[model samples]
Target: MIIQLHGRRHLLDVDLDIDIEEFTSHVLFGPSGSGKTTLLRVLAGLDPLDEGELRVDGKVWTQGSAIKVPARKRDIGLLFQDHALFPNMSVEENVAYGIPRAKRGDKRGIIQWALTQARAQGFTSRPVASLSGGEAQRIAFARALARQPRMLLLDEPLSALDTPTRESLRNDLRLLIHTSGIPTISVTHDRTEALVLADQVVVLINGTVHQIAHPSTVFEQPADAQVAAAVGVETASAGSIVRRTNGLAEVEVEGARVFAPEPSFSTNGVLVCVRAEDIALAKEQSVTSQRNQLMGVVTRISPHGSLMRVDIDAGWNIASFITRTALDELELRQGSTVVAAFKAPSVHLIPHD
Candidate 1:
């Protein structure tokens, strides 16, 4: 589906234009109050559409030319963070509520398909009030699918679940949406969700579209320092271009002359962005072919999911993500002497004023 939309919302201070083609799922990601939900709500036509032209699958839904289609006529399904299920209704009835009467002739079949696809089977007769957070969420997803929408808009649908449930259900949701053959736009603030589910990712910041690209591109090579931090490239250090040769930059950072990828601008100063995962930690000052390396003492070791985050201070602190096995092999601990090494291309240089 192809969409072109532009609008301004005064109260929210949102003014922007975005065009996207979602043959698969796209994640609209940003921090809270960053207009992620506003964009989703506008696309779903749940509220005022913020004065823009919205076209889907070659049909004009809105042109601001007296050609506005109401929400129901847009052939879209929407899910909210809260599920919005009827407290008094059973799961089946709640799912059926989203199916319009005109389409009710085969409603049972559609509801069953949705429930099965959502992994919500055997809970059709269960009361909404008695369901777990994850169970209720599956019902909500089934309700959205009951409409047989051409496009789906989800606003932080998995945010309400506990950590373990959210992670597990994320894969399920990704598989369900990909197999359903519908273009989807899901709003989220979690980068991990975007990484796992999005075929494309739109990074919105402070009511503006900051960057839009593949999850890997946006994460590995963010447009700026702010976007870098958002994608978990937690290492940002002040640096200066001592020299540029052969498209490589020699950046002097905190008394260490490190090499990194050259910047587009010929600025002398920059904020060097190094993803923790891209940086590797080793015991002692090892010799390596990597362009950037520094000898430092391990200052902290922290647990992150199944991986370990080791912080090293060689005058300047650097962080790296490695497997627990690697950490144990290296015997990494606070105050242990180590070296952090990364390739030149792994360092993203953001020019500073």
Candidate 2:
């Protein structure tokens, strides 16, 4: 399906053209207040566009001041951050409530099918109040499926749960949505979620579309500096290509030399982008195959989820993510000296104009 949406909302001025393959998941990803949810809501018909047009599959859904189709007739199922299940209702009742009046004739069949699809059939008779966060989310998903929507809009589907529960539900949700054959658009600020759930990722920042590509491309080869920062390229610095040999380019950033694959573009200025996870920390300079090694002092160390984010300063700032075990073994501290090593291929160079 093809969607062309152009409009303005509170803190949002968007112009997007998207093509979604049938049964594939598209992710709207960006930092907070980047208008990810706003775009999703507009597409769901929850809000009106100030001045623009929305067309789906060559059909106009909205014009400058007119809405051709209202929210109820859009055939979309939306799941919010909160599951929004009724506390007084049973799991079965909650799922049944989402069934349209036309489909209530086969209520039992529809409910059972949706619950089974969402893997929530076992809790059909359980009280909503007694269910866990993950269970409640599953019930909400089951309800959404009962509608048999042509499109699904999920706004932070797993954000309300704890880390472990979120991770587990993320996997289940991806499989359920794909197998159900429903095209989905999910909004998230979590990089891991975008990487795992999205067949295509739309990176929005400050209410603008910065990049649209596969998750790997968006994270590994950002289109520009804004997308690099939005997608969390932890170690990015302004540099210039000082020399090129064979297929390798040597870049200089604040007196520090970094080697990377040559860019296809003909340019001397570049922005070196490297993920924190790609950098390796060592207590001593070891002879390895890594093409780039910088001797730096540990400036700071902070907890990053299950890992540690170590900040170093060789001639410029750099960051690396390492496990706690490695931190302790390396004896890293605020003043410890260490070697940061990364292969040349790990460095992604974006042409800077």
Per-prediction TM-score: 0.88, 0.92
Candidate 1: tens digits of C-alpha lDDT, residues 230-349: 776878888889999998999888867788877889779898888888898777655677877888888889998889889888777788999999988997778888889889999888
Give me candidate 1's TM-score against the actual structure. Answer: 0.88
Clashing residue pairs, candidate 1? Answer: none
Residue 189, candidate 1: alpha-carbon lDDT: 87
Best candidate according to lDDT: 2
Superposition error at 244 for model 1 (Å): 2.5
Q: What would you estimate as the lDDT of candidate 1?
A: 0.81
Provide backbone clash counts, one per model: 0, 0
